[model samples]
Target: MGVGGRFGARESCGTARGVLQRVLDADRGVFETVARRHWPGADALLPRLSRAADHGVLWFAVAGAIAASRTPRARRAALRGVGSLALASATINTVGKRSVRRARPLLDVVPLVRRLEKQPHTTSFPSGHSASAAAFATGVALESPGWGAAVAPLAGAVALSRVYTGVHYPMDVLVGAALGVGAAFTARALVPTRDQARPPARPRAEAPALPHGAGLIMVVNSASGSSERALALRAALPLAKIVECEPQALEDELERAASLARVLGVCGGDGTVNAAARIALRHDLPLAVLPGGTLNHFAYDLGVEDVRGLARALERGDAVRVDVGMFSTEQRRGIFLNTCSLGVYPELVRERERWAGRIGGWPAGLLSAVRVLRADRHPLEARFQGRTHPLWLLFAGNGTYHRMGVMSGRRTDLADGQLDVRVVHGGRWPAVRLLSAALAGPLTRSPAHAAVQVPHLHMEHVSPGTLLAYDGEVTHVRGAVTLRKLPRALTVYRPMP
Candidate 1:
């Protein structure tokens, strides 16, 4: 309570108020400057642009267009964009706007033509439009740089339109953009990007560097709906022989190609790739995969995403040796490059195949899932390890499948020589147990499901007609079925980072 203490406290309070007043003065000055400035075509363009951004219509349209590309990476980028936008929008509405009760800027100096027809009636401290634009652009860029580059200009224009329309001060848009970027990073922290979760490059292998794909023979499955990609690949590798065949003739065409080629190549989905893998193994040829299907799990995991990536690998002769998963019974045997499963998933795959040709892939998959889960089904009984157990599903991946954020499963290392086995125990509600197991993912033991990594798995006393799905193809197994890995057995082409 002394004189000196009281004076010092008063001085500090006065200084803080002075700084706040100066900041407000500067922010208002900048707003007035932008409002009075004459910019060509902005009067007509910015107001319309700002109006178009209302309720995120512009961003959603952009996302839809990006998703229509039909590439996995494009789809992922679109999803990430929307996810980031959702987070930023939620935060702005819930916290940013509420915490600061600032009013909209004065419209006296702003050109009437540049003003929006219907002004937003909300706090102006942080612009929600700017936040959403920044979040979407940042999120898309995180997943795909090319798409991000294309989207960033639109985002920037949207943010600037907020200020140009006399709706927000410069600081509002800047702070909103900063918060938007923070939201994108927060979204990424919750679900790591694909590049962040890429597996380590190890156990490299050797293969011939065929410039322009001189000795590569590729078979394209016509049923997989990859004709456009096949044509692109043909243009990329002019010297390579490209054979397009029907579904029934795929195996025979692959056999013929493998017999005549130095490097066996295939373009299609996982099932077509599986057939090609078998042929490649038999001929002892290094395989080149071009992803041309709805879900190219094997091709994607191998880092051969498109014709450009595969062409680069072939030109540089870059390659790696990866493990192959095999499942065998008393009557039949087959190899898988991705995963094999028994139980509900196999049935889903079989059902999907039935309707896929008729209704198209994505819609058919949705229909199949609904049909399979609603039907009355019984659990498969089999002996596992040393004891018999009733199981609703048994999934064995060629390599340990890692869970990333909301992503179901992805393998980092393809040559780790281990099988990722997950079993959903039989329970009262099949749907609930299956959903729980899927959400739990790998290396976690739950009442609904248990996951384990093993070099081999043995299941005995299975019925003769038990269905098994491997690499998106289904087959029947009887008696004892053994699943094992072939360590570093398959050589495949890929670009090295």
Candidate 2:
């Protein structure tokens, strides 16, 4: 996992465990009374608080001013404090909630004793109400230390009420407190320091970035899944050129992409991506994939999805060079950027084509798939990188594999210059195999699975041309096609993210 994701996860687990430990051990009835005594039942307060926080968090900080609204000066100051919390809630809390979906005790484990409270009955992770309250209180106090003295108690009470009412646990309040305080502090810091008179100097300005020189040309089969979305992107990134291609127009599209966009972007089915990537070497362009089709394995791996996002990325997306794979038969040469499937997968693709034209989407797709999946074996002779044995199903992927419909294996580093291949041997029948084995999330613990890394791959069948698919398209080849690697081949639009 990335460091940011890992730290966020670790923070979540620690917070949840700490909260649960308190709740699981605490005397439940007592906890409820304590939260209630602070300012009556918090049920009435939280719903309103949550709505305001969604709008902005400054109100949470300003609640103290509301609590002490006797003098006109104090009332005005408290109102401003509320505004700040509102801003903080909308900008900081909302973003943080998505980043850390820590649930509340009531939502997770403890059952609430209902009493007519209006708390949200949704995902209880990290309570937004608590955080907003804490942050607003913290900011108001910072603005005027005397304000802190009054709001601090209120903030603590609000956080505690969540746990006491059985809406949130002790840990939920603590996380909310920390989040609020942190957000208030961060906003304070990010904003210009009110006390400092002389401004801090900024570093010298850098030169405007030079043009990347060349971009990837996208050839989309608009009829495929999301490629139809590309039309919206042209307006966003005027620099990008789009070529709508049919199955037979692969070569012409490749030629245009090679000449125009240095990196060829494909928006279509896996077959279309493979077809373009197959002869990419001869055309001499790198292949950038857009997931515009159903079951987009190549686009999924590429990390570029949806046309709007793709257009935005083009404005700031980096053009990173990645390695390409080659597949060749005796007389024909092709590219397999996603995977080359045998047996069930190859046969499934063929059978589904007719159904695809007939019934649309997952309904027809599922029915067609059940036919191939229900069968036991598709006997075929295969080898990996020229050595292996006679295997039933051998899939040579550019990198990675799938199990029970889930994408499996490490997302291979596109620039690593290696192909990730998987060999599967299943004896399970249709319904049985789908249910028992790969259906659940996560790869099967330790099945008869092996991953091999090879520079070159070749496959042959007993008869003339066995059904071989790149991505998922079954193309007509003379007899054999050689798979080769192309370094720094295509240019694609991708953001740093």
Candidate 3:
């Protein structure tokens, strides 16, 4: 670069170092006093604690334990903690240490008895161990305040151990702790927190029951969980026609059933049910949904938790009319029963699916969020509400999903005739806003993000070939897209109150 630029950079670096050294000088006397008078037992124990956190094994073990716990909230907090640690480590070890290259405190100042068995040789203005501890603790707290509270003491202990062991100055430890907290917030922005449960879906109108599923054809997805319970499904609705189909043949099978049966039924997860909803809409046939997916969000909302539940609903002819979300791009038009989105979420879904089989969905989802957020930084370009700007995610929910944590939940009214439109606005620190939303939710609202309920929205000037995810199915769409609610367009079987 130029001489002026080089001089300016050096001046800035010098100023920072001067300030840090001044802080260290002020605390050095107390740090030395603590180091000289350390207890004999702690002399050995403190070093071991430092080494345990050296490669971050301690934090990883703690995170793994939390993730392995049966509690869902604990698992989520663990992932968030780990993700924050990852960010802190990267910043402290690579960026902070390399750029500043601050020398470690002289061991001579410390008492002979307090000298560590193995002191670090690298530049050490900031303690990486302190950073990791602080970041992990802060990240966990963002997810679960109670768990965070539990971890705070340990985090403080770890941060203090850096100075107690004579490896880092009090200032270094303090700076590391600050960096760590910043890392946790950064990770939060990238990964969404657990979605809170919404109020139950409100039942709309109902239809008369059919006898033993007579004249009803059910397309069963063999890949879905229903296949394992095939016998139970058959026993539940013996008179209904069941056609087992693979993922590839699901649409064709549903189409054939739509033409042949008076009522079309589907036994699968939300994605499968979403497909069935489209066909049911086109064929003007009422849908019978049997809850069979992992979460069964849609089926549960429809009040069909099992085959028997569906049968009872159908036998009683209890059905409800629900709104559908439609998004049309230049390539094609489609429908959704739950939600659609662009930006970080679609990539998260793809990553989660890739790992879900090996580690299960929730854990895989957390892992995927970390991986994608750490790697994917660029924002997508899209135009909405007459303005073109970068965005992290633009979500449109069928019928207005209630905001719950980082994700949305069940709509109180399924036929509300509105799309829940939420966008994480792109800005100087889009990730920060995203993380704040994930943690604090709508309470973090500002110019950086927005959420609204609307009957229709036209998203113009979208980049061609941008991926739009709807009901877990991703479609590459180019150009402008229209998102509108199909008010009470599809009739679906549900239990009567």
Candidate 4:
């Protein structure tokens, strides 16, 4: 792959990117209302939080109910070590923040929804409270054998409390937690004691330095079900940095891939392929198609006819820019704001969402998909831009679909700054026809595949079965829907070849 792509933000995120912003708002609400003088910078908070967390996690992990829960010596060492390193990390971060000196919240004069009860003291660039909570929590996770499992949630709750109480910005909290986790991990790494198997540091494979411009690596998941696409990635692209996109981890990984990618690829369905494009904003990474599962859409976009072609794409591939959709959030993870549905498709996903390992793998997902298509492809009312759109089904996209899909064609240009919207006014017959055409394309002559493309549209499931699909996966928000364009809001990676 050769060149790069561009991206932008969605108007939707402006309104719905509330998870972190809400936390910030909450901080302004309660904390600023109470205090007027100062707030801690994110950096300052990390060191302090790290020290506190190290103390708490290490102590409780080995000394109390956690240890009594049956702690192993090596695990105990890793936990204690994690705290020590966290403290060191805090020292470095606090000094760094001080030097950076970002402005704190306007504790003194900023308007509030309510009157202040008191005042606060410290810088406000980063959230000290959040950092502390994250550090403390992560440190605990590092050290606790098993019984102390409650630490993670407790820490997260405390961090949220900081936002709820108005002590720190959401970014501050995230940064602080990052510091804490870094410290704990560093501390753990320093422990001479894995005294166990060889540490990652001592591994033979690590001999190759990850060059600053290391070749871009993409890990696509294609398994229709719960096969370890992750495992496949770890095995095939060991040199590439690893980021897991298991349903729960997709958003985080997408963010990482967008930021660090040279090329991005997937291993799942058309959904997974589309999911990758959702975040493929501006990083302009050539996409490499890898087939691990089934119905690989983005893979198809790359012109890889089969698994063998997937390998060939990686070998003799060229870089191409692609369009992507953006989302506000997912009930379980990050939202792509595009179509990953469920009413019809979700019914299928739901059947096996909980089934895991081999028993809950591909067969189950396949069976579920078929059942939902046959039983739950319920039609619904929809609204777009502003008009009512009566429909049997709908799929609004971020990128234009010109000819083929992932692996078959190029990833559409991302800088075009638009949404690729497709709607299916489906009924039983059309659905059947569409399915038949999908299996054997000559059926395209049928009315069932009444698919067309547009930009900036909205959808709603009035008849409601559960058709909310976000970034290729199903979600649970049914009713009048909205889809707004956020042009070029993100960045993705491409190869330099």
Ranking by TM-score: 1, 3, 2, 4
What does candidate 4's lDDT look like per residue over 1-497, in tens digits? Answer: 22322223444556567665886578556655434434445334523333444334533443454445322433453355345545744654566457545455553453242222443455655555455555545555554433236666656755654443454555666676677666665555644222222111110111112232245445444235524544544554455554444666765676677676555655556666555655553354444444345444444333333333333334443233333454332233343523444234445556656553556568778766665566643465555556664454555555553432211122334445555544455556545644544443211334444444454454544444444666445665656545555554433222221
Off by over 4 Å in 3: 1-208, 403-408, 428-430, 441-444
lDDT of 3 by residue, 1-497 (tens): 99999999999999999997887678787778777774757776676777788788989988887777534467779988988999999998788898877788878867665666788888887889999999999999988787899889888878878888789888788999999999998776666553323223344555656787788898989888577455666777788788998989999999999999989988888899988988988899999887667656777555555565677888888777888888888889988888899988888888888999999989998999888777747788987767888988888877665544344455656787878787887765655767765554532467778778889998888887677888887878778889888788888877664
What C-alpha lDDT, on a 0 to 100 scale, does residue 451 get in candidate 1?
A: 89
Kindly give the number of clashing pairs for every candidate: 0, 39, 7, 77
Q: State which candidate, 2 or 4, has the greater lDDT.
A: 2
lDDT of 1 by residue, 1-497 (tens): 99999999999999999999999899999999999899998887888888888888999999999999977788989999999999999999999999999999989999888888788889998999999999999999999999999999999999999999999999999999999999999999889887786666667788998888899988998877889888898899899889999989999999999888989999999989999999999999999998887778888877777788789989998889999999889988999999999988989999998998899889999999899889997888889688888889999999988877777788899999999999999878898998888777588898889988999999999877889999888888877999999999999998777
**What are the C-alpha RMSDs, in order, of all predicted structures?**
1.8, 16.5, 14.2, 26.8
Better of 1 and 4 by lDDT: 1
Instruction: Give the candidate number with the greatest lDDT.
Output: 1
Q: Give Cα-based local distance difference scores for all models.
A: 0.90, 0.56, 0.79, 0.47
Global lDDT of model 1 = 0.90
What lDDT would candidate 2 get against the real structure?
A: 0.56
Clashing pairs in 3: 188-435, 189-435, 207-317, 207-319, 208-317, 209-316, 209-317
* Candidate 2, residue 478: how far the Cα is off, in Å: 8.7
